[model samples]
Target: MCSLEKRGDVFILTITGDSDHRLNPELLDSITAAVAQVKSESTPSTALITTAQGKFFSNGYDQAWALSDPARPKIISKKLRLLVEDLISLPMPTIAAVNGHASAAGFILALSHDYLLMRRDRGYLYMSELDIGYPIPRWFVQLVRSKIGSPKIWRSVVMAAAKITAEMGVEWGIVDSAHNGIEATVEAAVKLGADLVGRKWGGEVYAANRRVVFADVLAVLGSDETVGDSGDADVASVMNHKL
Candidate 1:
């Protein structure tokens, strides 16, 4: 379901759909382990690119996983969320090449990366958390605030049940850069990583700077938008109607 390619020290982790790039538990575990190994094994001036093999980067968790084992949803969701948190906190640089629709938990996963580059012209990215009866988690909103600001835009994305479009993403600044397609996005991200790498502090300086920027947002997530919330009004709420 996923393949790890190493060029020099750069690790390109491409997630292929199960059959059609579908999600699988074992595949996810392998991807997570590859990331962990890269973090531990690679040296400075290294980079990681999280992208896809087929049209999409991911379709969130496998529908079959939930349907087949209804009782395991909570455990599975929690584990995936925590893994994403780890990905966000990784010491090395990370990039998200959003090749296609990134919905549900996939949005959360993309948000965890340091850089998000997308194929804007392809209508490639959408956040469908609200449509899935999933509550808006604090981390998700914090990511938006980290990129945009604290305003109606954030609430519209969070509380109002809205799907942020690619053009809107460019305006909001959540995506570091947008291009005509995935190839363009990757080229730009590679250049971005090249400019970022070999710098003093190994990109930790920028990561630290984000703490100052996200002070309030982080505090909000600590309370009302915890990863374990699953679904609740204050932190998360379910909805089916369109915004």
Candidate 2:
């Protein structure tokens, strides 16, 4: 489901296939392994760019698979949360080359990165839980809250289920920039990586700084004993709503 390649100090992780790139167990495992590979291979000068093939960056969790197995949902959720935490703490600078639609968990995945670049010609950054009849997870809300600074954008995304285009994403501080297509987005990410590498920051320090910046998210992710009292009421109600 993913491939890792190195071009000098920049590591490109691409999620392959024409599939929707859902976060099933197998795919999630593959992604976790890929991140581990990047961590092992990276140096102080190295950086990482995550992109995908075809029209989907990721469509979120594989609902059909989750429905088939009763326990799959919790497993997928925990794994995804851990994956985002891993990405946030990855030792090198990270950028998301959002090639296409990033919906639901996919949106959160992109937000987890240090920078986000999208294709202006196609695709959208959508929080699709409302439309899909799924509850948005509390950790995900923490993610949006940490990464995105605009309250208007937050309400629009979590409550209105806004389908944010590339340009709108940039305006809302959700994405760093918008490019013409997948190739352009990746190229820009590569260039950004190169520039950021020139800062000469140690990977460990960089990762630690990120942890501090997103300390709240880390706290929630590590909180296994906590229950209730998260995010907002209206959204949490819908998220915990039983069908």
Candidate 3:
């Protein structure tokens, strides 16, 4: 589920999901149109709010799709990777206005932001991939590396599919701020983004800094879906877990 609405100098991007906590694809192009509209109308200086309609951001993929048809995992993940990479490269700032828990691909999606904020009462942040026997992509590891310098921490997140609290996310730098509620968190994120933009002197200086940080690593990051796939056994294994 996705929808875009103009909010003054910013755009609100809401992730939508079905009743079962899966991406809504019963109709085609609905989400595509929303993302396109944001890209077309929003200014480069504008900020984006990455939130979800319901208590869950997205389970990443439909349970039926992931568990039933093997190819569905690869297909949907490829599209999802493309979309996530696009968000990472967006000239404007993107904020993770996390209203609820985001796991697996959802977790990586949230971390791609320039800043992140989450509500304290939101659902749990868990990586369900490892529980399912799936090996997360190297890019996911890279994103975590950008925040947390320890590979061991990421290895645990990747291997154990650990669930994290919002408060813990802030302490670990996974999220910029974890407020008591979503509305306040949103306002705070926008203020932080606006402050950064207002303080910026020249585009070249900031651009150069950004290039320096990401340029060296760009070559190391392979294709978005360079990680291996999760077969039926993997899905079945995840399904059997308490997570």
The candidate that achieves the highest lDDT relative to the unseen native structure: 2
Better of 2 and 3 by TM-score: 2
* lDDT per model vs. reference: 0.63, 0.84, 0.63
Q: Model 3, 120-203: lDDT tens per residue?
A: 887667777677665566666666777566667666666767787788777766767788777777777777767755654343
lDDT of 1 by residue, 1-243 (tens): 577777655678887653434445676677788788777766656778888755666656565654444343444455565566556556667888877767656766677677888877654445566655665556566666675565876666666646666677777766777788778877777777666665634535554655455555445543433324454332222222221
Better of 1 and 2 by TM-score: 2
Model 2: per-residue lDDT, tens digit, 147-195? Answer: 7778887999999999999999999988899999898999999999999
- Quote the RMSD, in angstroms, for model 3: 3.9
The candidate, 1 or 2, that scores higher on lDDT is 2
Position 180, candidate 1: lDDT: 83
Q: Give the lDDT of residue 103 in candidate 2.
A: 90
Off by over 4 Å in 3: 17-32, 200-212, 215-243
Residue 76 accuracy (lDDT) in model 2: 71
